[model samples]
Target: MPNDLQRFVFVLFDGFSNMVLASALEPLRAAKGLPNGPAIDWNICTIDGAPVTSSSGLTITPNASLSQISNKADIDYLVVVSGYGVRDHGTAKVRARLQNAAQHARHIIGIDTAAWILGCCDMLRGKAATIHWQELDQFADQFPDIAVSQDRFVQDGKLITSGGASTVMELMLHILTQQFGPAVAFDVSNLFVYDAENQYHLIRGADWLQGSGGDDLRRAVGAMMSRIETPVSLKDIAKQAGCSLRSLDRVFHDNLTMSPGKYYQMLRLGRARDLAQATDLPLSAIALQTGFTSSATLSRAFSKTFDTTIRTIRKSRAIR
Candidate 1:
């Protein structure tokens, strides 16, 4: 790595989410691709230097041990990517190590369950944050001081957090755009064939359904999620719910505070985001698979909603 490169240290714990790791790292790689691009450096690390396995059984070898890097002053960011047994890893030793790293690092990022680690480290106290949807209840129960939200991601000053794998790529792209200009970020996105306009959101599964107007709304949302590749219209969803379009709209307003059409679009976009962040599928293919008529259409709508492009989303994933 170049001497002037920004250094990023991604902390991996056992049973980490591979998707989160990919979402966090890919954008940095994309940043390096731009002409006269600023140098960016990243390395994977664990409590020890030993290889750690992902929740999906993918094993990754770390570049160095935490002990070696904990006190290093050169690191710019220390990102903890965790999943599953996050509470189990909240050992005193790990907490101390994180605190030591935070002393030197310019920023600390937590993805998915790793947010729990940050909370346990007392780094997220009183900060507005989010975690994976499934763990929201437990997270609140354990950390009452933290103001958690259902948003896809949250950034409180230098401490950034995402709900989980879904929001990790979005968070990374946000960082990339902030560090590198939109033009360089766009170039990086182009290489990945991602739509250039979709802003990333950190979504928790529960939030996706919360406030949905009762069983009718829940069923509509569920059907939409299950059939993202073949999106159904509001009218169709309303028919399935044995309600008229007007009734559907009223229910949606009562439950989700959005029209049925908007809800469906959000559902599709959410699924599209997950695929973009978690898979290497071409942008066009992803668009088609997510029920968009074309990549351009998806790009337009996604950008309108997310304020970023698809290319950036994919580029972010690529860095991971």
Candidate 2:
């Protein structure tokens, strides 16, 4: 709606995650807040231009109906934000509206369960996309034509799909980087206190570790992260990070209140937890991926750290 600005249209549906919507929109908001920043305009829209309710019982009023913007050249991107019970609310009219919008928009991005709708419309055919981890199995099975990834976000061709929430922030930052520059993106990340290294994949409790510790700590953690599948020894981690084993131990003690080995194990276990929950991969495969020598080792470490077995966690999530 603003003049001479990069325009984005976000299609909201019932039960959408407010966090995902905010994470995607906030970077643009931060950019606009910057002094003499370039213009970037966005509008919330629905199929019928009505108010939509989020999963958390929050209501959002759309700026315009999907049909109102027929001149696709005016819009830079169209994103669909849906959640929880998306399948229940999606109608033929909604699909038709998206199909019409896809004809005009430069790119179509899907968040959370929106990929399911996009797949239903046959828009993701031959494209690599990702959806919320919980739906990955169903998505792959339901749409044989789509290439699904477990990455937090996937941008294949003109189509972009994000897993959800925090991942949406990464997607938005990427969009900003493309539209403006890395400086703008970096500044925007600072505004949100976001860690860019945690882009699509990240450690579980490492968010708090960001910028609090010294560079050596960050470097050591980075090294550990980069070698999750084939874990490097602590001596190697310290050496590559330009620190002694004792120095690395002290840094971890001061920052994370644990030894470097324990912290790195947690990181690997975190990755194992993610893979175990998000993927249909076998326990043995997950073990190798997360640096455990065997499935039994992974199970023992997982139970020790989380106080629950990986199988139990997966089963509970499956039941939910």
Candidate 3:
């Protein structure tokens, strides 16, 4: 890996959610293969240097214990992946190790019930945070000082918290989109055949982009999603989103650093890629669904965009 890699340290408790861990980490794995994707690496650890079992009985050995995490100030995000028995892992010793890790990390993320652990360490006080919906009421009652939200995920400054597995995936993708642009993020989403319709609207994904993406951004992305099967003109998209074409362009430009036309094309191509990777649909059918007039046009565009043909990806996937 390059020295420029973004390092993530995953501190997993004994009952960590396997689904949530996979959702958080798999996108980072997929992102590395895409053009201009994030240069990222991760290490999984436990409170002690021991193997931990997931809620579903999957056992994972740690790269190191929390004490082994270097305090070189190179850690980008210290992610806490939690599960049902959250309190079971929240001993004073565990909190001390986590607090030690937090000091070296630039940011901290709590997935699912991990927010409780973070709160126990006083890391989330005075910040808007969330937890797995199962513990929301109890968490709110426990920590009245912290702003509690029922949104899919919350990113207040360096403290990030998510609801569950799917929301964690959304949070990861939103991070990808923020850092690597919409195209790479879109490809990562399609790699899993993940449909994000109405999901972004669910994201307090907007908290960070309060000023830039603003209200118009979601509206514009929403409109684009609704017309994925039959793409409309940029003007029509802007009109449907109740914003001017210039405002729509500005939204994409400011947030994604890409033109609206480019983002729309990428979005449609992502749909085509999803079809190619997961379905045996004919090229013409795929093209029609993704707003390409013909397979020839789609083939050329896909080759230009992804640097691999639909046939190549299909053959590769088949061999796997």
lDDT of 1 by residue, 1-320 (tens): 13376889988999988877886787688667443467888888998789999999999999888768766656788899899888899999889988888888888888888889999899999898889999988898999999988888888978888877547766766666566544344334434543212211222222223343455654555555566788777788777766778888887776545687886787577667768778888889989888999999998988898777778978877777
Model 3 clash count equals 0
Query: Can you write out model 3's per-residue Cα lDDT over 19-127, one digit (the tens) per residue?
Result: 9999999989988855435688889888887999999999998988877874544688899998989987778998898998888888899998999999999999899
Best by TM-score: 3
Ranked candidates, highest TM-score first:
3, 2, 1
Clashing residue pairs, backbone N/CA/C < 3 A, model 3: none
Candidate 3 — worst ten consecutive residues by lDDT sum?
202-211
Model 2: CA > 4 A from native: 1-4, 71-73, 194-320
Sorted by lDDT, highest first, which candidate order results?
A: 3, 2, 1
Error of 1 at 104 (Å): 0.6
Which of the numbered candidates is closest to the native, going by highest lDDT? 3
**Per-residue alpha-carbon lDDT of candidate 2 for residues 114-134, written as tens digits (9 for 90 to 100):** 999888777999999999999
Global CA lDDT computed for model 3:
0.82
Specify the poorest-scoring 10-residue window by lDDT in model 2. 200-209
